[model samples]
Target: MIFSALSPLLRSSALQNLTQQALLRMDAETAHGATISALKLGLAPQQTHTDPPELRIALCGLDLANPVGMAAGFDKNAEVPRPLAQMGFGMVEIGTVTPRPQAGNPRPRSFRIVEAGGVINRMGFNNEGHDAAYARLKGLRVPAALGVNIGANKDSEDFVADYVLGVKRFADLADYLTVNVSSPNTPGLRNLQADEALRRLLNEVLAARAKARVRVPVFLKIAPDLDETALDAIARVVLATDLDGLIVSNTTITRDTVAGMENANQTGGLSGKPLFNLSTQKLAQTRLRVGDLPIIGVGGIHSPQSAVAKFEAGANAIQLYSALVFGGLDLLDRIKRGLAAAVRAQGKTNVSELSGTQVADWAAGKAEL
Candidate 1:
């Protein structure tokens, strides 16, 4: 309760130090080892018997154990699925893996904007390639729903072929697949989101999914920087093509919200607290346009209130990356607890019932913010 009361102020500078200390405690190898170690310890022993079961989110016919998920880019190589699953994410999405191996952009690409609670990365879809990623996915013993984030190689001329090849190669290994056409870091990537190009790209990828004989849901990830007209067009194409769902945002190129932050001018997509409102607004707009299509909300969720805001904005589930970098692991538990408390306070039995229920309120609130 003391941390709760102080969170607003703590979120400013104190939280940054705490997160840095946490990050310093674990590098890639140690993080992986720690994750495995935690899993071996098992589910935190369910400390509070009186606590309600966390929200179970259902997407594209797959049921998740909770509404919180680790967004793509966290475990790019699919190396930490079992450990991530044990961390209690409703689901975990791995990769952004290209058809071929990629070294990504050069170092200093991923920068943490602590003051803004954001990260700007031009990591250019770095991964061990689809084959290697699939092999790792196949080898993991994750207890939670697993998804694959598929992308085209940076240097590839035939974008659609890359997606098609990925579907053919990795579809069966995943519970769901995301076609990431929204990343701003790769040259010519966001161009795929244009109306005509989107239609063609989606049609080809969906067709490839069918040919592969796999029935897993295929979702599309979009950028938050789109205007209303662009969002409408994109939604229309998804509906027309019958795609499974939409991850209503990857990151943003705009720096309007985090204008004063230290690394705010860095040339990459911006994510974290700065993107919370923008992405949520787009989520609401996309939900309005797409009607019943499920949305996986990603962007700047750093607290339970923000998670609730995302649910209110029409997200079927919520995902975060920058928050973890800024707020540390405790942020997840806090959000989960806060979300459950909010649902109970509202007299709702399930988290799904709250989805989109407050869109009008969220829109009104955003206007005020």
Candidate 2:
């Protein structure tokens, strides 16, 4: 009731901060739902400042005002991309939408690791099926570049076919499409990342893309828990294909950093502050192998420092989600401002110039975790 009554005053930093604290006290999923409801009602905080010119980036033919994007999963069913875009993300990605809707894992599927600035979720891609998301995204337009992350249904007979279907379905609706085979929640999904399977998956998905009325760029979202061999194999397969780019990681099943924390042993992918090192290292490694291909880094980017770390590690663009749980909408603006400052300090004219500058250090595991 307070949220509704004070809707017009959400732009006040003090009011928005209090609202964030209130949401943090509620159940994670309930808070998530309420946040989405507020956005749908156009009650979310709006961005009043323009992005700095140095932050502009041209990602895969899409001229983004900045390189920061809202990762998938936050707007899983495409209910609030327009509002999220208005809130300042240069890009807003929605879904991990399957061919068919499924309830996903049972209740209590999301857990917060407040002490570690992290979250563990076994949500299992619970999204309204293709038709639902497609209908919502069909005619909608937003200032930010829009991306649709797609996945196979839990019960699909042919996983590759499901991805092909996604490419065909949203090709005309989205600026880009993400082939998400890295989410740990879905059984056998990560197996799609194996070299041979990845090769086959990309071939079919790209073939389908070739038939689209409007060819959309496709990016492969990989997992953070990969060894040198697996990473090399993936790089090889990806380089051999016409895939537009790569999303350097999804969440990680490894809890090495949050070892003794509560919910550290949860059976789900871990994301947030603890994920930065591993994911950034993987991003650097992937960049080294893939050479000039574009990479959108995601995972554990909780601050502008971490955001800059992603670009220095070789991400042409970056996305964040879990951090929003702890830092609220203020985090987005803070990171953007921080990025502009960092770019100026580095004497770079554009934020894209920072990409891969520190790749050697990150890939060599020299950067502090």
Please report the candidate that would top TM-score against the real structure: 2
Report, for every candidate in turn, its global Cα lDDT versus the true structure.
0.78, 0.88
Candidate 2 versus truth, CA RMSD in Å, comes to: 3.1
Worst 10 residues of 2 by lDDT: 1-10
- Per-residue C-alpha lDDT of model 2 across residues 96-153, encoded as one tens digit per residue: 8999998899977888887998899999899889999999998898889999999999
lDDT of 1 by residue, 1-369 (tens): 001111221233423443335543543333433433443444222222222564876678887778888899877878767766665677889888998999988765766676777778888887889878888777567777899999999899899899998888887889889999999989999999999999999999999898766687999999998998998789888889879999988899999988877878889898888889988888888898898888999988988888998998889899876777556566777888988998899998888888998686655445313
| Every model's TM-score | 0.87, 0.95
lDDT of candidate model 1 versus the reference: 0.78
Q: Each candidate's root-mean-square deviation in Å?
A: 5.6, 3.1
